[model samples]
Target: MKSLFKIIIITVIFTSINSCKYYNFTGAKPIDADTFQVNYFQNNADLIEPGIERIFTLELQDIIQNQTSLNLVPQGGDLLYEGEIVDYRITPMTATADQRAAQNRLSITVLVRFSNKNKEEDDFEKRFSHFHDYPANEQMIGARLTAGLDEIYARITQDIFTESVAKW
Candidate 1:
């Protein structure tokens, strides 16, 4: 009876492991894709921030690479991501007693076009946006700008990853 119980537990463990071959904790479902490419994301926003295009492009590439097993390719990858920074805007979010701005929000929007060579049906074009809020008294430059950009990029890139591969 003890031997039978051990065998049952071992079989169950093996079955659970084997059944999760296609399951990724990150929720990425790249399926048949083995490689991906992120093209230069040009900054087409009306309020252009210098070097943001390069930074945003790298962020997208890094997120996909870090979360998935897909290799990065220069071209002709199984998955392709190309897009532009469509909007970068700062707006006053809250006002003080005197009607002065008390808080501000920095928002960034990216238009992405994802193509899956292995699965045409998975292709999509969408816009992902995110924002960071900070005190209105602080100028959006140097460390403040970097922090806001970092937060915004992290969210937008993750959303792109989810839409393009997570399939959740």
Candidate 2:
């Protein structure tokens, strides 16, 4: 009886592990293709932030690489991503008792064009945007700027991933 119980437990464990072969915790669906390319993202915003375009491009590539098994290629990949930064703006969000700004929000918007060579139906052009708020008293430079950009890019990149591959 004890041997039968052990056999049942081992069977359950093996079945569970095998069933997860195609499952991705990030909710990314398996693709028919294996390679991806990310072109340089141009900064076309009215307000230009130096190096942000490069940073954004790298961030997008990083998320896809970390979440999927696809290889990154310079060109002629099974999947392609290209875009431009459309807007970068800072605006006041809330006001204090004195009617002064209490918080400032930094917003970034990117226009993306994704092409799937293997499945043309999955191609799309979309805009992803996100923002981060900081105290009105603090300047948006150095570490503050870095943190804000990181937060915005993280969300925007994730959204891009969901739209392009995850289908969620």
Say which candidate scores most in lDDT.
2
At residue 136, give the lDDT of candidate 2.
Answer: 100
Q: Which consecutive 10 residues in model 1 have the weakest lDDT in total?
A: 21-30
State the C-alpha lDDT per candidate. Answer: 0.93, 0.95
- In terms of lDDT, the poorest run of 10 residues in model 2 is 18-27
Which segments of model 1 are wrong by more than 4 Å?
none
Steric overlap count per candidate: 0, 0
Task: Report how far residue 159 has shifted in candidate 1, in Å.
Answer: 0.7
lDDT of 1 at 23: 73
TM-score of each: 0.95, 0.90
Q: What is the per-residue lDDT of model 2 for residues 51-111, given as tens digits with 9 covering 90 to 100?
A: 9999999999999999999999999999999999999999999999999999999999999
lDDT of 2 at 26: 79
Candidate 1 residues 1-168, lDDT tens each?
999999999999998888667677788753788999999999999998999999999999999989989999999999999989999999999999999999999999999999999899999999999999999999999999999999999999988988888877
Clashing pairs in 1: none
